[model samples]
Target: MSEGFNEASGSIIVRDLIQVIHEQRAYLSEIDGAIGDGDHGINMDKGFTLTARRMEGQLLGMSESLKLLGDILVEEIGGSMGPLYGTFFKKMARVSKGIGVVDGRVLEQMLESAYQGILTIGDARVGDKTMVDTLDPALQALKLANSAGRGFSDALDAMVEGAHAGWQSTKDMIARVGRASRLGERSRGTLDAGATSCYLIIKTLAQSMKELSK
Candidate 1:
């Protein structure tokens, strides 16, 4: 869980976002190798790399960076994940609007927006063993915490727990969606590759926040 959003302007820089996005590909690759195409990592890295190249030196504000990144992801990234993730970041960027920085409440909102996009685009619900598993519950929990007026740190803590719980739920899910679904019952014991990657990437983001706190 992260503490209240730091009002500091550099809460997250554009360069760091690109770096993290590229790094996420490596993380995805590692996870996917266990049960899926193993290219999830490569796909994400390419997406972010393309995004970085397109932006060049133009990423001044949070909105500008994210908006440009979103279009690049949707247009350039060559997978189902591209549109889903593109939609997610786009929604986050939209929620951010012009705010240079946001509090934890907005963080929760951004996550929910992404989750909704995945739901609409992927047409998958819970038990489908997609990234939705990792995001849906996290956003739901965050919404609850936000309504309760919990501190930003406490709310984010709940989100972490929700994320992990969702990640775990994937193990029992028979892959009803994605390429893994072709294996049918064979996919039951293993976690959804996409879900696992989502968990890892989100965990990395949380870890980054923790480091920022220090």
Candidate 2:
């Protein structure tokens, strides 16, 4: 059987995600400034920082930690990001609630749930130059890799690659949703802030999963 990571120790993955968001907070804001209200990173950092504080000294399992983060994002944060990311993590938590190990199949299921959850909350589509662009591709890649019998680490690598490519693809897309959509063709030159953040989150998760699998 393929190797998997213990769900009990997977809280570290959430910690790593928080660290990356904190580190890239300013950069994410910069990306948002180009076409958004310029508060994407700031809001994200605030919520994630709060999550970190709330989790301090606590050793929760992956599902529990995800639930905490999701609840905080939905309750404490404002703007569209709050609900969007909250649903994302919450759906993931639901999928992984009782799993002993997070193997490729479990990870794929988690990604699918998160992706679908986001879709249910918004009207964004693949070419809409939204976070869906990054998330959809990543989920598809992971699903493909898992179905093909690839190792968990390799499937994660594929997921990261898909996310990065999707993120990059947003730079040349005319925004079809969000405030950036108001820019019309002018939005084509800048990267979508949501897509960029989605890419970073997926990349961090993939990296953490790879290490845990090792």
Candidate 3:
């Protein structure tokens, strides 16, 4: 039963997120091509890479790093995802600020804030084949695990599983929001690009937190 990671050293978590987004750029674009403008990956990669460049040689804590990333995304990235994800990270940063140990409770709070922030800016919901599909379930799993007295590491594992399951669930859903909605039933067979990227972000965060807990 590990407690949690040090917020000061957690900048690596953001770095990992940037790396994953860059690595998955092509895949994300391909997924978006099925029902979007096919630029999700490119746009995400550009924003995250720029964040990484700005973060180089900095010794910021997790909250600071998240805020920086969020700011960059909002200010520099294009399209709807920019504002949505920017709000998500910024909200998480607010909850995480000054937390010494990012334990299960703190993580839950951060995730809830991020989730609510997304809801505030976007109309997307669980069945909408959007990032909300993955984010909401992951937040619920973390919250449920923490409430059940699970260890921090276990809670993170639960969050990852929930995110993965939610991402997979998107394949069977018809788009109810975004450009994909125009496809109607045609959107059912493809995975939502936003959901996939959201899953990756959650998965990366969970894994990084698990490692830091050690």
User: What are the Cα lDDT values of the candidates?
Assistant: 0.72, 0.92, 0.93
Candidate number of the best lDDT: 3
lDDT of 3: 0.93
Model 2 agreement with the true structure over 1-214: per-residue lDDT tens digits? 2488999889988899899999999999999999998999999999999999999999798888898889999999979899999999999999999899999899999989999899999889999999999999898999899999998888888999999999999999999988899999999889999999999999999888878877
Q: Write the per-residue lDDT of candidate 1 for residues 95-120, one digit (tens) a residue.
A: 87766446667787778787877888
State TM-scores per candidate. Answer: 0.84, 0.98, 0.98
Clashes of each: 0, 0, 0
Instruction: Tally clashing residue pairs in candidate 3.
Output: 0
Cα deviation of 38, candidate 2, in Å:
0.6
State residue 67's C-alpha deviation in candidate 2, in Å. Answer: 1.0
For model 1 the local lDDT of residue 33 reads: 66
Higher-ranked by lDDT: 2 or 3 = 3
The collision pairs in model 1 are: none
lDDT of 2 at 179: 86
User: Candidate 1 at residue 98, lDDT?
Assistant: 63
